[model samples]
Target: MSGQDTSEVGHGHGHGHGHGHSRSRTVAGLLSRVGHAIRPHSHDTADKTDQALEASSKGMRVLAVSFAALMATALVQSVIVAVSGSIALLGDTLHNFADALTALPLAIAFSLGRRAATRRFTYGYGRAEDLAGIVIVLLIAASAALAGYEAVVRLMHPQDVEALGWVAAAGVIGFLGNEAVARYRIKVGREIGSAALVADGLHARTDGFTSLAVLLGAGGAALGFPIADPIVGLAITAAICFVLRDAAREIYHRLMDAVDPRLVEQAESILSGVPGVKGVGSVRLRWIGHALRAEVDIQVSDRLSLVEAHAVAVAAEHRLIHDLPRLTAATVHADPDGSDGIDHHAVLATHR
Candidate 1:
């Protein structure tokens, strides 16, 4: 028998085995039917799965590199500020150190996220990326709070800052380094659909902007306007707080499994286009890291046999997976037209 026939037999056997149905002749016939159903799209499905895996792997590698570079630059800045004795530089240095610390967890999360699903983790480690993003948000918030407090203290005490030129020079270096890394990460992250990498890129970009503020603050302090340093520090703190708030809101929505209405509509349109589907019942889509998990229900004729229904549902699943770029899995539950007394279309429409 051909590979297609073998795959069909395997699929039929899987379902039959679960139900403890022992009809050898019937199984053979069903397997042949499945083979016919699946043959046309087999190659396409395989290609899409391959592409998804490749893209995910490449994205993780880019994230690792970006995180490492950011950490190294942050460590150097921290050391420089410690020796220079400039409050604005010291604050910038501490912020960079915190950013460096966040990178370690991000690296681990990226590594875990790239692994295949196992018995212990049915969905793989994809959620690790999302969790890492949440941690980074919290870290940013903490950094902002610390900086704000320090800035306020400086404002009240009004201490003299030494080595303004050196501090400004370090800020310039940080600004350049951060801008380069941030732009690189952002470009790659969007291509691969990696939220964690994208968030880190934003963090790096923000750091670059804050570094400019630090430079200005130090320069102003040197020219005898000591208050400029404290004011700039306060501005940096406020920006960090704003970023943290937005990140937290996004994280909360994702964790709650909020479905994007547009994706649901897209899935519905795809499924409804299938030959045997009489109507689309419901469509649901959820994000699992950079990937999506989609579930759909369809209404078919009551006159159709169980085998026909199964075939149609399977075909729809295959089409949905192929059509949607980020979908990791697609499930279709078949329902007899108007049999369950639930208006599936109505439910889906309400959701949309």
Candidate 2:
């Protein structure tokens, strides 16, 4: 027994069966993280980026269909703007066209995200989706700037907008097109757990509201108050800036590896239920594209053999995957249950 190897486990500071910590995370983040923990990939097959790639296919299909609809709407609005010389219609046309173009970078991102992992980029190209989010934020900001500028200019030099009825109709058309696209993108984005797609959908929703502002302007101009057009455009600009701020925040959280606190709770619950686990340690989760990857530490009895400890860890991992269908990969660490447990800090430093 003295010569036989035994595996000991110990927990780090804070997390234990009795420890309480503030959790900051969303339900979406929680579910995604839980999913990754439930469907863990073994360390030997960690390079299986195919799972990530296949998940992005749904987003691509959504982008394709939405792009076509927006393009047609923009084209129609641009022709009307050119013929009518309505400053208000011009703002709406530019916004519709700009919003439509956003799908370009997003499309590229989804394609890149589906690529297999490489040695230089071991995590694969999933972060490209976050980069696309930045692109979206910028596009939204640009639209806001353009709208504000046009509104100020129109306010200073009020112009008699021609074809008031047609301008009014165009505004309604923009609203309908944007609303439909928004609903579709948001629905699919949620289904696929794509933050980028969801953000883009929010952007479209704001655009739809701005389109209605164009309607207000058209209506006011018809009633002989020409300044109403630019006023609505200014209002639309403010709304766009609001959307930009929110979308950027969500992407920032992703880049920072922020996951919902519920995921931690979910992980701990499963680890605690494992037959050999004595105490659950730290559990962390993050979204890489739409998939979640989980890393957790568990404490086992000091008396357990090295093989037994490893088996316990394996068992915990299997249970996680069995419980959550969305979880794709997990890394579980087993520690000896006591203060005299293996000095992981020292061992980690040695490995580093």
Q: How big is the positional error of residue 225 in model 1, measured in Å on the Cα after superposition? A: 0.6
**Candidate 1, 1-352: lDDT as tens digits:** 0011112212120111111236685567558657766563566546645655666667657656666776777777777667765667666766776665666676667567667666677666777767877788778878888888888898998877777877788788778777887888788778866666677778778888888888888878878998888888888888777767777777787788776678888888888787667888668787777777766777776655677667767667777777866775666777767455766447589667
Candidate 1, superposed: residue stretches over 4 Å from native: 1-33, 36-49, 338-352
**Candidate lDDT values, in order:** 0.69, 0.72
Question: Top TM-score: which candidate number?
Answer: 2
TM-score quality measure for candidate 1: 0.80
Question: How much is the lDDT of residue 88 in candidate 1?
Answer: 71
- Give residue 102's lDDT in candidate 2 (0 to 100): 84
TM-score of each: 0.80, 0.82
lDDT of 1: 0.69
Lowest lDDT 10-mer window, candidate 1? 10-19
